[model samples]
Target: MARRKRRKTRVVITGISGRLGQLLTRRLHRLEDHEIIGIDRRFFRRRPKDVEHLRIDIRRKACEDLFRTKKIDVIYHLGLMHDPRRGSQEHHTWNILGTQRVFDYARRHGVPKVVLLSSTDVYGPQDDNPAFISEDAPLLGAQRFSQIRDLISVDMMAQSYFWKAPEIETVVLRPVHILGGVDNAMSNYLRLQRPPVIFGFDPMMQVIHEEDMVSAIHAAATPGLRGIYNVTGPDALPLRRLVGLAGKKPLEMPHVLAPTIARQAWMMRLLDAPAAELEYLRFAVTVDGSRAKQLLRLNPQYSAADSARAALRLGAWDAPSDAANQAEDSKGATAA
Candidate 1:
């Protein structure tokens, strides 16, 4: 008698309705032997034909039912909250506690693989920061910015799980400035008609196109790929140049007073992220992706600058004319 063929791998992904989540779900759903199971509090325009989407929070006890029913082999933890307001209880509950709950059950259920999505902002922007930061760098992103404290804590949790459970394959991906046609904090900031920039500071930054981010997730799901990986686009661009490339004017301002001004804008709901995120414009937190390229074989198809340009166009910001933008930039004025 012939040997039986192996069963397909059933993979669960949280935040399935999110733009990035949907992208990854669609890609993995098309795979020949991969089953897609999604967990989200909401749904998008449409889901894949065979995907099983459950509208439940990750922390809910009902999650175990999915594992028991599907015998899930791997899970993609991509659910993250991006509210910039300080002391958001929901951010902590969803981003941190939710992760705790997911890992807790996965280990209990004997799930063997987990892939986590983290942001490069964990390194924090500092003048002393090396031009090319690696995984070994200290994650001080939560120092002044308490908003991202949950991200750092969750990152630590993932790292802890990697060591504590030697049998499991835990892969953590920290990508810089994830952007595409989607509108997120970084993307929305970049799409502004005249985004603010720290005076006399032009920090270098990297951005990974959303497509590449999804590709990295796909690679992380492979059998043997497990570890911390830095995924980024091709090149780094200066703050002013980046905005110009996006057909937007740069509003120069003092880094000292920027926080207060930004907070006001945030309260008025003019800007998506709080003042803490503006540190990216003051210092470079550029990451080196050579390890991910060699280990996960992530071939980022889109360049950072090109992604920024395309994202700007897609966001449909009513950017002022080139002459007007130049005039405003020359005055070093402020934007409301």
Candidate 2:
């Protein structure tokens, strides 16, 4: 008698059009046994032919049908909004209500595993923060950066699922500042020809390569893994050195003037982030990845220098094509 072949794992990835999502899709696509289905409001350009891409909002009724019909093995909720440009109400609804819907669907459809990619920024940078923050640290990210509060809510909501749905494995990976060809605050900041740094302040920072972050998620997706874990890359380093590694000259601004300047620049659409975000430059928010290392078996594969170079490389943002323009225009029509 011949041995039986295992069935394919049906995985659904939200935000599959984003850079990090795209990277994860490619990685999982290589494994022929994983059937990939993407749920996003954005169009996935040049996606793998085998991967099914659905341009729909997670909060929509249609999205629920995907769960009701497909026997999904894992759900990767990466659709949380991080763009500060969006209105507060839009941001809150997308991150908070959207998360609630995902969890509800998993519970309703009996999905076994759900992985949420949260950021370590939820811990917030503080003047008196410990040298190595743990996953148990309080989430004060919204204290100064109000925009991050929605994200904190999402992370907390995911945590609630552990108790609310005990049978389902809920793994939340709070990775440090991820660098590489991604459209995040850190990546955008590094893309500046002259990055800004606060005068008289050089806080230590930790960053993970986009690939390493995807790797962490892969490790967390394994069977029977649950709970929150802090994922990090190489050891922490001073902000100035990290900036230098990105091949950009730091434009030092007095702490007093920096906030006002950032606010004004943000208002004029010159800066991507708000003034409160400067706290990361003045205070360290490094996290301990020992839990992930021991449990998820996650190991950072890219060096800080390698991550820096990848962030600065040509076309890091990958300019969108015409289809993307259409997607953007109609994305608001749906519940995101």
Candidate 3:
């Protein structure tokens, strides 16, 4: 009898032009059995030769043509927008409708697995939150922060796929503040020369290194794993300690005046995030990652300090000099 050859897994990753998408693409491309297909409206700089990059909106009819033609084994949904400055209607349409289209394509194409990169911020920072929130907790992240409602809607849509399409293994990962060379709000804040802080408030925070988050996504995309999981780093630390780890000083502001100042900054286009994001600075929204550890067999390799250092473009996994990275981060903030 002749030996049989295995087929390559065809993987589709949306938002493939973002920093995290670039990281995931490199990791997956290294695997000989994986064929990478990137879908995004932005340019994929330094794109890998073997990988296919499609610069198109996920909401467009053309996005469905990819599913119609190829045998896509898995879909990594990382296309959810998070910029607070974008209009609410635009955000909702892009996130909710675009995500619905992805799920519809998966169902129609018979894709066996779908992995969504949701954020722990969907849980919303609150004073009454448990010490460690589990997967079953209510998503109140948008209760006060209306801007994130689209994210919450997308998460709920993915969750609905669990029961609606049982054949497709839907895995939603709500990772805590993701810190690295990425241009997210948390990373950008840490890169600030003197990051602002709520006076007399130092909430406990959890963060995952960008690489660890990609690892968790890979684990979730495995053959048998399904359902929602809260992915977290190895440890948690206070907000001030995280800021200190990033080699920055905290400029404390009284809680009463912080929102007003944030609004002014927003009006003057000085702040990347709106005043509503300040809620995260005052309360905790830590999650329990025991499910991911036991089920997905995920063991985070980065410490809180290591993650914080990565945000500043320092340490072993450094990308570029702080000056260069800060400039790029500012230029690329809303691009993703």
The deviation in Å at residue 25 for candidate 3 is 0.6
Candidate 3 residue lDDT tens string, 113-160: 999999999999899999899999999998888888889989999999
Between candidates 1 and 2, which one is better according to TM-score? 2
- Identify the superior model by TM-score, candidate 1 or candidate 3: 3
State the local distance difference test value for candidate 1: 0.81
lDDT of each: 0.81, 0.89, 0.88
Candidate 1 backbone clash number: 0
Q: Residue 228 CA error for candidate 2 (Å)?
A: 0.3
lDDT of 1 by residue, 107-143 (tens): 8888888999998989899889988899988899988
| Candidate 3 stretches greater than 4 Å from native | 1-4, 314-336
TM-score of each: 0.89, 0.92, 0.92
Candidate 2 ranges beyond 4 A from true positions:
1-4, 314-336
Output the worst ten-in-a-row residue range by lDDT, candidate 1: 315-324
